[model samples]
Target: MLDESLLDDPEALARADRRELLRGAAEAGARVRTAVRHATEAGIAELKPDGRPRAVLIAGPGLAATGVAELLGTLAGASCPTTRLTPTGVAPASGALRWELPGWAGPVDLLLIATPDGSEPGLELLVEQAYRRGCSVVAVAPAGTPIVESVQGTHGLFVPMATAPYEPTEPLAASAPGVLWALLTPLLVLLDRTGLVSAPPEALEKVADRLDSVAERCGPAIAPYSNPAKTLAAELAEALPVIWTEGTSAGPAGRRFTAALAELAGRPALTAELPEALAAHSVLLAGALAAGADPDDFFRDRVEEAQALHARVVLLRDRPAGGLTAAPAARELALSHDTAISELEPEEGGELETLAELIAVTDFAAVYLALASRA
Candidate 1:
């Protein structure tokens, strides 16, 4: 059970969050709002073109890279291909993209490097490589860091994120799902200027509005009975989560959601695209069901041991559109196997709003799960 009483008890909830994860999560909506101001002041309004860039590359370490890749990918959508580069192992000097550039048929026209803390050996090396290759670069990091200095007069642009009251001094990984908004807003604004993505003038307003709305709905002040995030956390407790999304628009958000589940809740989650997941996940679900309880066991044992093998399927979708969502089939499949299922779809809006809704909700759920586990 979720301990509904705890959701309304500030003292109990605070005790559950040893790392103040809830604090970071709660400020996410405000963080995005703050990011908009930073992005505008950074002068990303003026971007020098690289003459129809062949491809866009976003490289960073940890959540920074993932956020950029996913957010940029969603914004850029089909306009231009995007790739995210990450370090595999710890050979700082080797860099993550050092050996991977050869496969591209042509040079990367644009490369954005983000290191929330402003320093990552691998990311620095990647920045050097982009400079050497003459790619137009935009490096987002802290002010006065090596990354900001290294990109100083080169063909690169530096967008620095100053530490704000909304952002804790802790590492970006600990502040993620919240930090992502600031890290990604500038790139979205730049992409909008580049004519690659269509971000209307009210777009940021819509995003902020959605973020604020979700925050209100899922905030600590809300009771579990009325809070969607808390309810979802309760449903996911003591069960493995298999997450799949309806379309590519929500793909990056889904990936980020899973990452939050892992980081905040200390739970591993599996995520995949639709059509593919339907076939691949069926086998795993079948085996899990087969190994455990009978499908028709209405009076099965309620022993703790019996629940250990349980799993839940979470499907994320956009609420406005209704073309070919995977929820129906996926839900049916899970129910057939006697597995629990839950679905989350953000309120109707453009791609970004949908992304914000799903992410904000899942982000809160992850924090609540972390809090509930400790309680």
Candidate 2:
């Protein structure tokens, strides 16, 4: 178990936070609320749909792109066809690569560009491509950045990033969550306007409220015994965490958790959809059991020298609404191998509220895990 005493000691927790990431984590609620207010006040509801597009393309660079891709993918399911641009390699020069998307010649393709800082070579290339192809583009970026300048000549909508209390960073824990909110806020507004998704004004407020509740529950002053995030951290310490979730909304939430664990806690976590993960991880658990056993004592020397195997399962579920197919089988396998399990479920609310709850909890867990390990 983690040093539970540190969970309630602000000084000790601050010391454990080597990079001062906790400030950003603590303010996540306010940041999200601001994002919602900003998007609502920006007059996105006034936008008129220029007919339904053939497909939606979400493009960006770095962690910003990941957030956009996840949210867009979730909202796009069975409603609008969607594609994501992978920001891996060097971007092509302007007009060097022509987009061959079907129906690009007309107002049938919508490209949403996300660049929090508004300056990236690949994203710039994408903007240029969009301008050349006469594709409708929507952008979320900081005002006065290169991307805003680049979009001057195009038929694009630009939503400036909401005011941040501090300078943001690239790591998920440091700044990505806030930026994620900024990018998603306007998109949610547009989705609502298009009848693609239902994100009422009250929905945004509910999401913010959910985040606030999570922040209070996971704050440093909360005792570990009462704090779900801290408790999860204690369970995850000295163990490899395998995070899985069922349902469209929870899938992205799981991915965000893995990213936080890997980046903030410096712990590698595996994330996957359920049932499929059950089968694959079942084999893994069986392998760990075989590796750790010394049934015949013939290879006792090698067995004794082997590193300790500590695998933990973390299941994120939206229960009573979405059901799991192989949770029972997976639980049986994990129990047989003596692997610990941690399950996280969001408080009852809308999709955004549930997502905010899961994300806030996991974010605090990652930070607490990092602090506890340092201690």
Give the TM-score of each candidate.
0.87, 0.85
Instruction: Itemize residue pairs with steric clashes in candidate 2.
Output: none
Q: Find the candidate with the highest lDDT and give its number.
A: 1
Model 2's alpha-carbon lDDT is 0.71
Off by over 4 Å in 1: 1-5, 48-51, 91-108, 166-175, 289-306, 319-322
Which tens-of-lDDT digit does each residue in 339-369 have in candidate 1?
A: 7888887777888888888888888888888
Against the hidden true structure, what lDDT does model 1 obtain?
Answer: 0.72
lDDT of each: 0.72, 0.71
Clashing pairs in 1: none
What TM-score does prediction 2 earn? Answer: 0.85
For model 1, what is the alpha-carbon lDDT of residue 284? 72
Q: What are the runs in model 2 whose C-alpha is more than 4 Å off?
A: 1-5, 16-20, 90-106, 168-175, 289-307, 320-325
